[model samples]
Target: MTEHAPTTYLLAGGGTAGHVNPLLAVADALRAREPEASVLVLGTKEGLEARLVPERGYELLIVDKVPFPRRPNAAAARFPLVWRRAVAQVRRHIRDRDVDVVVGFGGYASAPAYVAARREGIPYVVHEANARPGLANVLGARRAARVGVTFAGTPLRGGEVVGMPLRREIVELDRAALRDEAATTFGLDASRPVLLVFGGSLGARRLNDTLAESWPAIVGAGWQILHAAGERNELVDSAHPDYRIVPYLDRMDLAFALADAVVARSGAATVSELTALGIPAVYVPYAVGNGEQALNAASAVAAGAARLIPDAEFTPDRVRGEVVPLLADPETLGALRAAAEASAPAARAGTAAVVAQIDEALGRSAR
Candidate 1:
């Protein structure tokens, strides 16, 4: 009997958690399914993947950080040489590792990986995590073997809604069963409804300021607060019995379990996780970006699974007027929860669907 060779995969992406997290999730799933297979990561030395991929027990291949120049500047003049070098670097890695397939999550490294894979006649897949596709993914999707997206209606060629590949802790979490433990972990009353608030790792100053002004009213309305005030944030924890503020939340699964409702940014991962877990939320789209955050939360708002509060409008008055009222109205909150639950089927199948896509691409390459 002949033994088949182990499949080798080159998973590429990384910069922010938005790109790195999904890439790691898919890598973990691939490794779990086929322990003998080689799962490698391609990233820049400066990216989050440099640290995270190694920590996750995957080999990290270095790539040049070649940013696509937007305007006609000095960098634009040098782009051709830099871009070619990046592509050649990826090609060398592909040749050395004998990579069977390249899966990209869209970052500095992925654009070159896509080019290298195409040049080497290897199949490659693209996963876009936002409703507004990134420039790299947009370019890759044109000739990719398969294109997957976290949200529906993303304007990428051949893109399919594959949801967001989430962390295992989130995917396996049993919120109801873990509520009491989560409440104790945060020193909160599990019997009372808790409003969980966060704004990524650096913390959103807008969210921190607004909450500081309105926590008194929120706690007074019979709801407790469990707020992750970002690592760099200066928001001090108040001595109020119902308010608990922490610098960061290492165990977001527990925080999710204790949360009756959430007030946070509408990042792609955040939106996907909330919808998948059937957690009703009021989203404040970070106003700094190209309006993608607002676009990320649109479908949920349209489905009555969540509410949107623009950054400029997410003031203390708005929280008191809308958020506090919603908390007091259990009927509306229940409806939002039910809507989120109803919308969860597609959101929860992301990891499996992405793996299926990779398998299909491999099969096609073999044929």
Candidate 2:
């Protein structure tokens, strides 16, 4: 009997944490399962992947960020030349690395990877992390051997709802076990229910403003607040010790453990993590994009796992009227927590599902 060679995987994505995080989760899963497999990451030097991929001990293959043209401008006219060059770069890397399959998380690097992989007669898979698909994944989905979506109702050909692949730390986290430690870290009473408020890494101006103004109300409701107010936020109030305001929390797992509920923007990762952990949330969708943030929070809201507050309606008045009452109501919070757990997809299994798709694609190619 002959020993089959180890499979080589090339994951293409980047430009944002949404793309990078899922890609890394899947890569970590693959590496953990098959220690000898060659895992390569394709991204532009300017993206977070340039630093992150190498730091995670994966081979980094640089690609040009050749964006597709939208309007008929001079840049649009020159797109064909640049796009072809990007595809060529990917093809060269594919050939040199002997890559068996390509996996794409939608980003600037993914379009070229899709084209090159298709042209090279190599199998590829696509994972779209939002309810609304990006242009790169939209084009790539046509010929992809398999496609996965993090949210339901994503309109992609052959798309399957596989949930978002989360980091190992998040996947294996035990909130109950860590509650005491988390409370200690935040300098809060573990016995009291805590509310966590954050808006991405840099923080949301609206969230900070509203929460700062409503801090007294939140504390008076007998809920401790762990607020990540961003590094640049100017809201200062040292008087309220129960309302802990930190610029950032390096250990988010600890924060999550201490949170009975959360109020924040409905970004893909944030929504996924909150639901996966069975924590109820009041999502203030960032009033940007093609309403994708609101769309991302739809399933949770529909299932009674979360509540949606439009950016315009999220204010101190709203927090005092709606949020404070909700925080005070344990029955409602319990129901929301239950719904969140039931609505959440099997997050830890997401990587396995994508890997299964890759295996099926490989099997077809072998035949």
Candidate 3:
């Protein structure tokens, strides 16, 4: 009789689709390489990962971790308790389920699991999706066997830079079909160019505020708007019949297909997806975290796939300057679109490397 080795992966992180999606990408890669591999996701119950992860068919394990408390006031006193609870959850999962490599995507949500993996002498790796390491990734870095960085310029100084991990759905979208579907579904007239605006999940308040205020000016210019506003965004209404406001967009393939241009935050995954689809975008990287958002948008802008708008001037003048010109010309739009497409992932072959790493790590652990 032949004996086969067992494989188990514990993916940890949550708080946003951005964090969870990359882990999903890695998981997809892992599964493709080893069809028999068992994968489980560890995240907070209230986060999108708990629902999105399992809904996407991965085993979902809810942990006690919360998003890292950024502001000093309210969550400061409560963090230790959260961390302690999270540690307990990690210990319980690792012991009962027999985790192999506990891969962490960036977020405070992954900290306890990473720490637990370290104490248990289990193989662990950290995958950071941003140019600057987030608090969670940074904490896990010291103990991680080999950190994974998506952006080439990540400041970790130690981890291997493997580039961004993108979902298979996004990477393999049928753009033309999406465009036609989006046009018909959203009542967009294909004759006029579509301007896509969205804020992932929590929505962009400042962006929502400015767009709502500038609605007359935008619509007056004869361009169509397909806006995906966040659930909590209170800035605008569906007052104008031409305006479409949904908290979340179900068909981003359709949304991106409908877009002649995109106005969005330059998150690593967003840029990666945009590049993957070869979509031209006007990037407004949020002005926070030592300008990490600005950094995320930089390569795309340099590659001519996108245009960056400084956060301060992201208002009327700059938006008008950047948005109006592209609205009219097919030649410029075509060039940027081609450039974005050209800059997209070559084969999305990061999966094989990841699976090899996991296999090697587990192999050594068994010794």
* Strongest candidate by TM-score: 1
Tens-place lDDT per residue, model 1, 1-367, is 3345788999999998999999999999988977899999999999999898999999999999999999999999999999999999999999999999999999999999999999999999999999999999999999999999988899999999899998888888899999999999999999999999999998899999999999988998899999999999988888998999999999999999999999999999999999989999999999996999999999999999999999999999999999999998989999999999898877888988899899888873221
Which 10-residue window in model 2 sums to the lowest lDDT? 358-367
Which 10 residues in a row give candidate 1 its minimum summed lDDT?
A: 358-367
> How should the candidates be ordered by TM-score, best one leading?
1, 2, 3
Q: TM-score of every model?
A: 0.97, 0.96, 0.85
Overall local distance difference test of candidate 3: 0.77
Q: lDDT, candidate 3, residue 86?
A: 83
Cα lDDT tens digits for candidate 2, 42-74: 999999999899999888999998878889999
lDDT of each: 0.93, 0.90, 0.77
Candidate 2 residues lying further than 4 Å off, grouped into runs, are 1-4, 364-367
Q: Who wins the lDDT comparison?
A: 1
Predicted structure 2: lDDT: 0.90
- The candidate with the higher TM-score, 1 or 3, is 1
